[model samples]
Target: MSDRNDNKPQTPWAKNLAIWAMIVLALIVGVSLVSGQNSGSDGTVIAYSDFIEKVDEGAVESVEIQGQELNGNMTNGQAFVTYAPDDPGLVSRLEEKGVTFNAQPAEGRSLMGAILIQMVPLLLLVGIWIFFMRQMQNGAGKGAMGFGKSRAKMLTEKSGRVTFDDVAGIDEAREELQEIVDFLKDPSKFARLGGRIPKGALLVGSPGTGKTLLARAIAGEAEVPFFSISGSDFVEMFVGVGASRVRDMFEQAKKSAPCIIFIDEIDAVGRSRGAGLGGGNDEREQTLNQLLVEMDGFDANEGIIIIAATNRPDVLDPALLRPGRFDRQVVVPRPDIEGREKILEVHMKKVPLAPDVIARTIARGTPGFSGADLANLVNEAALLAARQGKKLVGMAQFEEAKDKVMMGSERKSMVMTEDEKKMTAYHEAGHALVSIYEAASDPIHKATIIPRGRALGMVMRLPERDEYSYHRDKMHANLAVAMGGRVAEEIIFGYDKVSSGASSDIQYATSLARNMVTQWGMSDKVGPVMLTENQQEVFLGQQISQQKNVSESTAQLIDAEVKRIVEGGLARAKEVLTGHEDQLHALAGALLEYETLSGDEIKILLDGGDINRTDGPKPRTIGPATGASAIPKAGTRAGRSDGEPDGAVPEGA
Candidate 1:
């Protein structure tokens, strides 16, 4: 710190003196030009006496005045009043004014002298600036040569700005990497017990799980020199540049000995050997080879650690992950509810958040969201609040932002037909009704027919808080709920064409059902055998596995299981809608009439309440009424809209 201040050099006095001298010289030249002008003659007029002298007498023309000027023929020594043809000289017809002019070749130094004089100061300034530039650039050039140096970042001590406190979700993975951080901080302690540092660690997960952020924390904690580079950075256009960079990086790491190097998206250079070998000389493959060689060559005692991150770790070269190179693989998966709350707190630091906004609730609403998404959610929430001209991010804004991110901005202007609005309302209500009656189903968090994203309607639900793993009952329940919308459309509207809005829901449900039969132990015909190996989807920080588990006979059974799951749900939806046929017709008519209905308004119609009572749904209740206006308000009214009161379910089954 002392040297930082003391190193400030005293600027050369001669440089300052030279600059001041130039400024003074310019002022002197300017003053001389102004003083040399004529006295008593108005400066406004342009009287070209020299031009008048040069012109032939035959070419003379009488002066003509323009723009309030009184111009006379040029009279040289006296008033010969000689006029030049080019001038079309000042007119004598105009009203006389005090304007007069005597142009004297815009007097100053001669052309050569002015240019020479001006060049003196400019040359001095340019010379001084270039002198400094070369001095700085030369120093910079020396550092540039070091580009071949290793870009592996470091994290030594556990005393970094981010600790386990800053991390959320994927607890198992976090705990595992924490130990590595501890080992680096005290290698001697581990060595005393014959425990040694692994040469490298690979982090494999889906995108947005904060893999890179964790690496940064490691660097901060280790308090060691950290070199950060992309796996892509190791590659170059030249045939051997990749390998050369790899060698230079390792050499630098050897010098810094106790440092850390982080290579993100290692799959870029670490793809399977011979996978893309057009020849053995491909730049990416060469980089991977050099990396493998260096990792194997570097001794454990050298104290240099390599950490690489990739979302597509499955495609990486196996040699890079083998024992000699990356000894451990850490998986950073999506945050759970608790993890999400912690992450929310971390990201909410600068947001002016409402005291009542609940992070846990928001987290529950957002399943499968990565740290990056949560961060984005928080930012979107802030923006939402700002749009409302609010100082703090409120719960409503958070919910709105969540909807915007998950779905899309409200298409308030996308007008729907009367029949379309009613269809959407019943379609959405059907999902809520089936889920409510199903014993194995999760509680509905939100159910709306509001058109959002690509959906004309939607319903968000939550599973039992304690369910860590999936079950047969839950899976069946999900399938039923997913089919509820289509079933509602058919049961009420009759074998009518279904909208493609439920395409995603069906796809998700189908995948889950397939997994249940083919992979998870929930299947009746197939046992718990893995159908596919775990593949790392790096961006999400999760392990995605596939299955080839079922035999041909069992494959038929699996398809049956999937269809059975979907049909059961659809049948349940049909049964519910048919049971309340009168109410269904009334609600649909109301939806057609209103063109939009909020959850409360729809509930009122179902509850057979008064139409004038427009109070929205109670906070605790969720149903077709919840946020229903998002649809009905958007179209031409052509059907009945029944605003009914809320009601409880019948006594028992």
Candidate 2:
């Protein structure tokens, strides 16, 4: 009964009509039963004397007697009923009167009652049949017929609000896609120059880089229809369902020429054809094949543009990326510093921001944030402001939001024993102290013994600036900083007293060391050789890999190299922490006292000063030289500082 007609086969009006008809039929049947009961009780009631007079006068057309009741239709065509006394001569009286009468018992079922009981169940069966029939026609039955129908959701002109201006970051990709918008708006502009619009432009990026948003922006800018669907939509459990859907989608696209078709996460169906264990007969492969054919079959001059977005472009079929198909590939990488600033501004438009909030500062601190991350960061800041009942979101709120996003929500409800708290304080202090001294390490921004996220305590360092590539010293310094806590523990509690709290730290350092030797070829022994082969689908967020063509001895050598690097970093960490033992103790005490410390307070403490920094001796320079002198001893496979093996150590010793 709604004004809008749904594309679904089941119409609401039809369903309502069936329901109303069932109600009306039930009402009519009920009324008929009531009227039948009333009719059986109709006619006039008479006393016993009146009945006798009628019988004697022979005015009754017919008479019936039963125990104490008499009923008859008179000779004048009048109907009457009367109650008789239980007299033995009642039947004889009727005989004497010579009236056409018959005696009957009163124990038979009513005709109307029997008819209603049978008819009610029949009507119920009919109503049930209609209900199921409509259900079948609505979805299940229609599904059998609609397997070939496109599932893409079409957006009218007004449905989309995103335009090119609304999308920030990835400037190069934005510029590359601008022409497609122009082509959609006026195809003749390019045709006059004997040029055809690119058949397709594939947007490739890591997740949350705004690839799908860019596609929607293109549609909005072109002011054309937009059809959005996921790659999985074309696939179904049936073998050929995917191919049929692909064909149907193209057909619909042709009808809406000058429109855009955006298939997000295209890698779901477009993965390499023979990559699966099932071989080429897989439904996904078939769907991908049909998609290739449709892209090839369509004419670019017809003004239809297909834009597919996928994070795993490396796994896509080659045929789908051929020259005549998706010839243009755009990389939508994570936003850089300026790009992140712009993204923040875009998201901040609706937020009531205090004047002190600086996007550039936040952007600088967030080195590898994507556009989506920046938006979430801004929104989180706004939410924090609202939670605090503030009129405007301030810079402090943004800073808090960033911490929450990076580290996680503060776990205020978590309780820790006094000994555990002290141990955590020392562990975080060790990290902060080492980060400040490591030349290649990022600056220590904050340190806290207050539990946050899954961590009991944390030390956070904000990158000074974004670096596109990592240097050898930076990696080495990062490893040493990661091991600093364990080293500090070793110095304080000795080897046997170390806790398992540094498990995550050890894992991170080991991964870095392994990557250096295998993937990065940074190991002196590996000599720029790739000892490990990364799978093509690394962009899928899974780091699956296999060893390259190498002998077992070579693999052992690689493992030894990784172990050597980790030990060297650990030795360096031990040297730094041991040399600055007093400073480490001071920092840990400050953390224990306050439960949290800002980067500025840490810097002051590192300068041999207190938190207040009023009056204290000028501190020694905490530089890379604190542990730079340590080196591997000759003829030793282990990390040796002055001819002594660096044993496995606990954190914050």
Candidate 3:
């Protein structure tokens, strides 16, 4: 079932080796023949004197040569004749010393060979047309090609098994789509009261928040035919093909009315016109134009609602989002903590997970995780447990799986010299210490020097369970936590060198700082004014919004405020770690040996070496006092005895 669904529409492209061999042979033969023919006949070839004699007269009706007719062209002042005489022995009889012959005209056979030579080009043109037709036919034969491809996967009542029950996150989006479901189930309920179904609803969101899932749910709950296609399907190499495809798709949709047309990534086609990105006449523009015409022009009674999903709503054309086209844009953003917990619960229900595996704990650990990430996390845990022949996925596995999803799998084998290893250990230690000590900060989970994905080291922190709202102090604490790594390195080693492993950390911290000044209005100098516009490109091949409505002094002030916030966090981190220098050295030394140490292990050292440090790879060893909540322990370097693979927690995954 999975295989069939994966390769749906059944566009079978079985290559015939014999046929390809024949095509290659034909191409080689054609090339050779054409090359030789071109050499033989570049232009008209005529006998110089013979053709000139005929040109003196007007359109020589016939040539009378010694009272006999002749035929040729008068090109280049010559008439070349291709006539072989009737008698085989005539060539010997024609060369008498003093005899001279003159020509006048010929009858039916005049210029026949020359005409055939001119027809060669026409023959080649016909051959080219035939080849193109064959190619088009071949494509058409394989699952409807040459014409526009409607990627719309159709689902009937029986096929669409997914319903709102299957979707866990996105309460707001679910409510909006439920109305559509209500309308589809009973159209006349609204019609009887003199109301019309919305012509279209644009589902807008960041990727993987279950927009497509909701569309399917509607198809399931409404029990109507659903046609799913992507916006990219409309674009084609040939001009006007996209427009034609748009018309064809609508025509089909109209016939399959009372259905849903779910378009994934509409921004691919419905981008703003004259953006000069693809000049106005590109295939996307044409498709978008046709779509606009169809959407507004269609009767509301058609009941063929359109749902589009995209991460970037700003790039979409205004026409497509306007009143008559898409009546509402349903936002399916990253789920909050409760939504995430529900999502996690749904994904884990089928897996052999331990009863103690707290979904809320996992959800809080993943601050920005989407539905897709949660799904992947469940799979990862299951896979990890299965590989180790475990009965159930424990919290340890889930924590590791979460890290695998966010930071990528741990790079346990990344060999580092003693000096580099120590630096990274101290760096991550700084972050962990800051988060642990900060009043507004979330709990720390794990601090590691082990290479994971792109970073040489990392500090993982877990927010409070079911925490949705963000306070300014908490945001500042998070940024400060991010800056602590660099600060630790700078404070001890002097501000000589810093690796860009902290690039993501820096960008995130800077954005938060600026947002506080501008968007969040948490700054003193900025005075509660929103200034998200102050964002600017900080690195290569990046786009950042310009800092708006300020002067040089204000810019300096904003920079100072950001520096002050980060510095305060770093100073706090320094104070915490420095005050406990003996513990810091002890932790870094252990990191030097193992390249990674769990929060419990660090805490055991912090708490004067009280706990059993030798109890290897276990679950949730850190309690409320440890402050390592945000760290993903399941995908941690210590858990599962392997790195995170594919950011997906696979069952036995």
Candidate 4:
């Protein structure tokens, strides 16, 4: 199937070859006729005077005159020709010279030869057109013959470059897939115990989590044929084309039993049917229906395993996820600390790195990095090293790579005015100070005035450990942190003088505060009821917007509650900044001087001594809590609030 010519419609090579042969034959015959005419023509044209002079000298041996033309052999055995003059004594003159002259009619081109000469090129052109037309028809693989063919690329064991060793991170997912590989290796072992192998396994994960790599590993480990395709490959604009292709792919898979059929991004075709603004595509629906029937119809022990990957598993059709279809669901979640370390190690093998670079430390700093992200980090670090003419990638390069991956590439070319630069420094300084005083907030990692990504300046925080959930107090602290920049601007320069650098901060702060009241049930007026639908669509993998079910009065109350939470966070931030007015100015001054500051540097200057090695806040507990029990009372230590000793929402850096 990999041979391109195999998919092309068979052309009548014999007939085309015959036509080309005929064209060549005609060309050869035409050339032969032209050659015959040239070879049989009078040897050379001579002047009539020269002809007479030759005759007078008896240099001409024999001559033949035909109408106005003359031909003869000279005494020296050289042949020549000349136009006969209007002399009536020409024949007598020749006879006197014993030239052996005779009257002969000039031969013209043969009727068949003239026809062949004129028509050969035309025939050749027609033959070429026919030949190309046949090739075009075959090359396109269209018309009736191609509609049902599978678009899958078949890979053999030899073609598999990635084995299980090449895949790292998401160990649980790999373990699940290893079962499928084992089944392919020895189907009889399971059969003896009455254990039927799963007909299909579905890999659910965000992009770049190595789902496809795991698929390749399965094929390589099992040493079997692999049929790989994408979900979109099954569908076409034409109705029934997708269904036809589904059937054809399965047919091909049956021939290569004990094989794996991997479909990347299955959600493209497997999306929930009959949903969305406009009606779903008929062709895609038909393709999905055919797929359902095929999976249901196949025997579980057939040694043909189908594996599919998609990030949007929430939006998939329920029928596709049934037990008989994709019996095993492998969740390829983002790697944790240990997993990230392993993934980094795998990627670091190919890169020349300084001995001081520690994968574990890097992994600890990167909380949610997937395998692909780690690989990219390694590559970016290598690129940075090469740019600096360094022989090996160092820790500094890795740090820069991580910053680039998280924030964005540095925009050194971007020109910033003096006013903008000062504002940005003060703005980042505000965030840093707030994060430090707010017990619920994560520790300040680094604050920078240098432009990176879209931000004019940024204040980054790093959690001591991975944080999986956020509580009410932490949510409030985050809201305050987001608004800190604006509050600082308001404090330094009056409200009217504040710049627009806090636009993004205000937006995020408003969202967080609103979610606290509406979704987290932290508002006192709205009670503990869930008011909004935050549920995500299974197939589309997006949050579905649900209308508010509360009454108008209740809606007003919700709005007021949201505003109150935001105001509380804002008030707390303003208080913290106002009390530490001197500290804010000092931090801003340091940022302006350094253009960047590490967490320890900021802490050292704030503490007015060496950096304090203090313990971080306690981890925020998970699960939903009822009522406004944890809501802090007004003026409760500014940012800490009056809740559990460490009731702040924890966040991953």
Candidate 5:
């Protein structure tokens, strides 16, 4: 049944041609009827006096009268027509002249002409109605009467098919889904061992973690029919429409048994019922209820494996997460070092990479990059190489691409005063100095005074390896590093002359300090208890019903603790900069000269060594002393205090 429906031919052209032919026929018939009426009078015209004179002279053979008009045949057999004035003696005159005449009624329409004239309007109306109905039926799986039909599309293997080999960096998720594919390919193999086929699998992860890609890979590997749809496709403004769509979708799936149904971003329709204020949405709740039944209802949906992807599994309904509905929950997390290296290799296959480009090194530099981010990085590198008119993407291009993705594109065209440049140099140098001097902080990756994105200057740090959890000493070191810019400005330019470049720096430091005190329980006074309230959505009923966890006294204590943490970091930064003023000045001067410097260059400059930059900055390998970190750029513009750029900060920066 499904195959026949899929193979059905569309006859829009034929239908339109038929309608046009009918209209043309109707027009021809109408034209012929009008022309026939006009051509009915084929005789020559004669004056009334001439016609009467002919009748009196006995020259007329016969005459026919209709109202005031008369038609007669002369003795010569010629036809003539004439109009007569009101003459009551015409009949007697005709009789005396020996002319035969008769009275006749006026001509009326023929039966066929009348029927054609009436039916033309009805036929035109019917044709127009059918055209509109077909148009509705052909649009986005919708029809004039099929408003509740499912919009799920059956994905074919011919359209950019992705196999398991194409998916990288998410081995665990792939392995879990592979079993389902195996069962789909040979269900009897699993059945021999008393194994039951899993009903569904849920792919949960952060955005860009390759959840949807993995789902597609499963379909490709299994070589089965794939039906793909979004959760939003099941929902509509009208009530009960979503429920009907769910039923229709499952019916289609049943026809193609042993197929996969992939639903991306299922959170849109599977959110918990009665969760938000005003008792939640009735229509959405009903839709979710229907979906729940369809997944693991009384009647089994055998041979049909459901695959769904969502980043927000926390909001999904509890019933949907049970064992029978979604038998497996696959977590596709961001790739670590090895996984990133593999992912980079996968994307680099399409690009012409130079001999100097090493995937492992680039992967180490990008510690927490996802599969999608790695692909973007490779693409950006290729674009950079293309812009420079290079035939191959080299290590230098990859380095620059990584920097652009991690921070932002350099704003070299932005005009800055000489004084602002010097200040920005000093500010960035301070951050580098603190990161270098502090033992617990990550190593400085690079320092630059060039304007990038919204920042006037920025100093970056990278971990020796991927650091999942931060230690207390590391957090304290990070706090000092964050305060480095402001502390440098206060010491060099004095408190009254300090600029607003430290606004983002202060915001970042304050947020870190608060999280440490209220959330992390790093504060001695706050202890291990969480004093901060869980942030809920504004529309959620719990947000309105719940009160703050902290009292007035506790709130004050938290504020004081956050302030103390920030000030301690400031004092530490001041102490470090005060002791190493000469090195700070040296690093700042190098930044002003080169506009940018790597960690090795900064180290060389601090040690009173000159860099030979005639060949450009040399590529440095990631080592124990080399790493990367994201720091918000300081704003230099006057009367603009809020310095945070839109989407400038990276995740966990």
Candidate 6:
């Protein structure tokens, strides 16, 4: 038991106590040495006149004088001390009184005491300096003298290791990187076929699509030493520091040949050099230059392979992506419906799911979710179930979590007047009614009068399948749907009483109409030529010096075409709403009663059937439509007189 206790790790508190104890012991020793120099001053003191009377009466037996102070033994065998005045006759009086005396020097600090007092502060300063230097070395992988050394860390398998089995939703990217793994494992296999392993592979995709994870899987599959560094680690304020670090990194990689080096967000240093207004960053460019040489210079880095990930591939330097440097570019795009199902299954394994939780249904609902989004969805569902003290995550929880993730969480605590509620119901009803009647519009997934995010009400629509492009008819239908809310408000409340809730709707319609005329070349008047310039970064010098792409007459023509398209859609919406005013009132009344309604519920209400009936008609499938998923408004508060209705469009609109 004693040995076991001794071998146990010490806590931080115990270590601190031991260090303090050593410091206190050193202070005690120093104090004792200084005190030792004045050890013989323990006798009782007497006045000078009393000392003179004692000597005259012959009470002093013997005396020792040091400067003006005197120490003597009384004739009664007691010790005493006294200070003598400036009297040269004191020694002669002592001799007349037959007292034996000796002369000595005055008391002062010893040599050792003086030295200890001076060394304490110097020792503390040196200790503090050493402590800071050690901290810098630990944090940067180098002290002040080694500032140019590489900060790359060699990854170890102490944490649960990741492999290809753990990756999903990106099979193509994984397969592309598989060749690199094979080459590293058996170089002779590829050598016999006269094929050289590519020097590097670049992973490009939107964020959270698993670019970094793919790199890790490659390293794991090959069972080679992995060195990980961030691109920003090479840059510093001092000139040439970045370049020196890059060279040091390659040297370390060469020592561990046949290993893999992974750099994340390489665009930080690999951006196009000298493209800005005032040339470019000197340190960053030097670093990039050194990196380019190490990759494909005269001296070949034969056994080492480099893999880098970046989302902004367009901003990177051209030389960095050449065939000799990065031979392969693997795209890790957001997962499709089937791929989403696979990803959902991978994340679902960690959660305890109920019988009604279907992966396919969830995947179909989350059309554009990446792998990270799917994982978060599962975690949210599990958390909801835990909050309710349930044994497993149910379909109901998953549905609620999806709504919370897609829309902003519901704002149930917000207060509103009855008039505001009525207005919101009519506004959403118009959107739902137009979607139901439009042949090319997407089917309504759900519509609600309850406040969500910044909008007082919203209508969410989902496509039957993922759409890569939009048709002309679909775009027109989208325009009509976007205008429906404002059009409905104008018809029901009169033009003067219309609310500002349609601000977002109008903005969406305007942007779409302009893009159709200017970019997609849908307007016959504008012809097939693009009238707008492509958006680029502000740092590019050409953006400042270049002239407008369109002439004055062409610009006027483009604006006129956009106005024509938006008004056509608005007229179409008005015609539809005027012909079906009764249905619009019915939808609004149902929303006031239910607060929320599903597509099936709305269809039943519209068909003159009781939605509360247990045996109501089955929901009919609607045709595919192209429109934004959620249209949110800014002026949700009641009694606001602001004319501007701030609205927002969904992603990829």
Among these predictions, the greatest TM-score belongs to: 5
lDDT of 4: 0.73
Q: Per-residue lDDT tens digits of candidate 2, residues 1-653?
A: 11121332444567758676886787687677767644534569888888878778878778766545566898888888787877777667778878888776753446657677568767777777776666544432245566767788775445447888999978999999998877766778989989888878899998899998898788667766677899988878888888988877777777666667899999889888787564665788789878887787654335667899999989998989888889799999888777888899889998988999888878876766778778888889999999999999999799788767755676656554566666666777777778778898877767766544445566766565666677899788878888887787778778896777676667667877998998888988878887753224354787566534777787788889989999988988888898899999999888777766778998888898767634433321111101111111111111112321111111211
TM-score, cand. 5? 0.75
lDDT of 4 by residue, 93-154 (tens): 88887778678775665676778778878887887887677655442234455776787876
Models ranked on lDDT: 5, 6, 4, 2, 3, 1
Off by over 4 Å in 1: 1-164, 298-301, 466-469, 494-565, 581-653
List candidate 3 segments past 4 Å from native.
Answer: 1-153, 157-160, 277-279, 282-286, 298-301, 417-427, 465-472, 475-566, 582-609, 613-653
Number of the predicted model whose lDDT against the real structure is largest:
5
Full candidate order by TM-score, most accurate first: 5, 6, 4, 2, 1, 3
Clashes of each: 67, 14, 47, 8, 4, 3
Q: Write the per-residue lDDT of candidate 5 for residues 280-324, one digit (tens) a residue.
A: 887788889999898888888888888999999999999999999
Q: How close is candidate 4 to the true structure, as a TM-score?
A: 0.72
lDDT of 5 at 615: 70
Stretches > 4 Å off in candidate 5: 1-122, 136-140, 276-280, 360-369, 395-409, 490-498, 510-579, 615-653
Candidate 3 local Cα displacement, residue 617, angstroms: 9.4
Identify the runs in model 2 with alpha carbons over 4 angstroms from their true place.
1-142, 157-160, 274-279, 282-286, 298-301, 379-391, 395-397, 490-500, 514-582, 608-653
What tens-digit string does per-residue lDDT give for candidate 3 at 211-243? Answer: 888887887787666777788888877778788
Number of clashes found in candidate 3: 47
Clashing pairs in 6: 441-625, 442-625, 504-647
Candidate 1, 1-653: lDDT as tens digits: 01222332344556656656766676675555444332223323444554343233422333333323323443342222222344344322111322244333333445655566566567667756654554443311123343344444333343445656677666787777777778877778889999878888899888899998888777666645666788877776666767877887777667666767899888888888775446554777777877887888644436778888999988877777888588889988777767777888888887988888988887766666789988999999998788789988888788778777766665554565555656676766766666666687766565555555444455555443424565677667666766676677777667755655455455556776677766776655556654542333444666465444446676676688767666665676677767877776665555444433444565566688745635533222112211221111101111112221211110000
Provide TM-scores for the models.
0.64, 0.70, 0.64, 0.72, 0.75, 0.73
Relative to the unseen true structure, what is the C-alpha lDDT of residue 448 in candidate 3, on a scale of 0 to 100? Answer: 59
lDDT of all predictions: 0.61, 0.73, 0.64, 0.73, 0.78, 0.77
What lDDT would candidate 5 get against the real structure? 0.78
lDDT winner between 2 and 4, please give it. Answer: 4
Error of 4 at 82 (Å): 11
Flag the better candidate by lDDT, 1 or 2. Answer: 2
